[model samples]
Target: MSLRYTFINVLVSIALLSSCSTPKGITYMQGMFEEMPQEIIQQSRITVQPDDKLSIVVSSKDPELAEVFNLAVARHQVGQSITNNNNMQQTALFTVSPSGFINYPVIGEIYIAGLNRQEVAQLIQKELISQNLLKDPVVTVEFMNTTVSVLGDVSHPGEYPIDRDDLNVIQAISKAGDLNITGLRENVLVVRKKDEKNIAYRLDLTNAQSLFQSPAFYLRQNDIVYVEPNNMKKRQSTVNGNTVQTPSLWISIISLLTTISVLVFK
Candidate 1:
């Protein structure tokens, strides 16, 4: 081949190779977008825990009769009054005892720990009917302190309320603010309490199947979800006190090599 033709051919090959190569910037690695698992959706069940405040309201056709049973009776009052002791009057704040029982008005003590809100409500309704306190009681139980914390690489980092009983890890992350581009998908941390012990779970959102089998997929009350930033973010900020910048360094090297190749070829 002629010198000019060979030179042109070489330049074209270089350009094609460079084009196929990843750009010299933050590259989003594959295996990040995962589908919702069916089994996870089916088996995501969380039970109540001690020290969790629950709001129980029972209503009947006869409002007066319902109110009578719902009244704050002396014998059923176990915890110090939030109004008198803490100077706060929150009706839903019923602290579950270490024994898993709650001292509800008129109903006395009912064991509710390890039960879901719906389960507790149904149990209360059954109790009211069995005791003949009301003809048919409409009981509603709500968690007052169903809060989850999301920190690290989130738009809003802090505590958020979990309105529903079945909140998955991804939903919790969205609530805190969806993960940033630099957020690490393989090392998302879930800090939760299980069997009275604090447990930390590392979840990999990159794999589509990992969340399906993960026990930490279901978020519990007072659980903390943390999304650590990728190496790019670490170099940009003083996050976690580590000054490592691997992503940035890789991008710089790649960009320099690309620029040098284009100039030499031209």
Candidate 2:
């Protein structure tokens, strides 16, 4: 073969090899068959914690009786008494104390931390009935400030509110626009704070059973899901933090050189 033909062949071979190299572990929940066992599906529930804000509302057949148990926002001027009208009173957010208690009206200090919304509501309902406060009372509880933080290698890394009672890790990741292709899905880290101690769990998105069985699969309030960058991304960051040294850049350079050589040889 001539010198020009050999040069072209070499450039073509390099480009082919670079193009054929595919990234592994990019697909999530690998080996997830169509017929998944019922035991593998885990139920996730959000539990209340200290520093959490809750919105509790009490309702009964008699509106006046239930109003005494519900918390209301009251505004007062310097010269006026703290007068609150039923129409003007809005449901106020109750902040859980550091000791995991909320000083609810009529009920006094109630320990709600470590309990889910349904449990909290039930506790309040039972309190009203047992204390003879309301014959037919209904209590509803909602988490006002529960959120999860997603960071690193995600399209949108920020705090996403836990709107529902069961916000799992997969849903949280989806809220952040899913992980980028350069993210290391095989080793995603989930950091959680339980009992005032920070606990970390590693989850592999490529494995279906492992992800479902991990405790981190069910994300809690203030949970942090961090997606580390893959090896190629780390190398790109180390090398001037640009695409100049990437395989695509080399392919472009080789294509340009080949075009010039063909013109000269012709």
Candidate number with greatest TM-score = 2
Scored by lDDT, model 1 comes in at: 0.74
Error of 2 at 35 (Å): 5.9
Give candidate 2 misplaced runs (Cα > 4 Å): 1-15, 34-43, 75-88, 239-245, 248-266
Residue 244 C-alpha lDDT in model 2? 67
Question: Largest lDDT belongs to which candidate?
Answer: 2
**Per-model CA lDDT versus the true structure:** 0.74, 0.87
lDDT of the structure predicted as candidate 2: 0.87
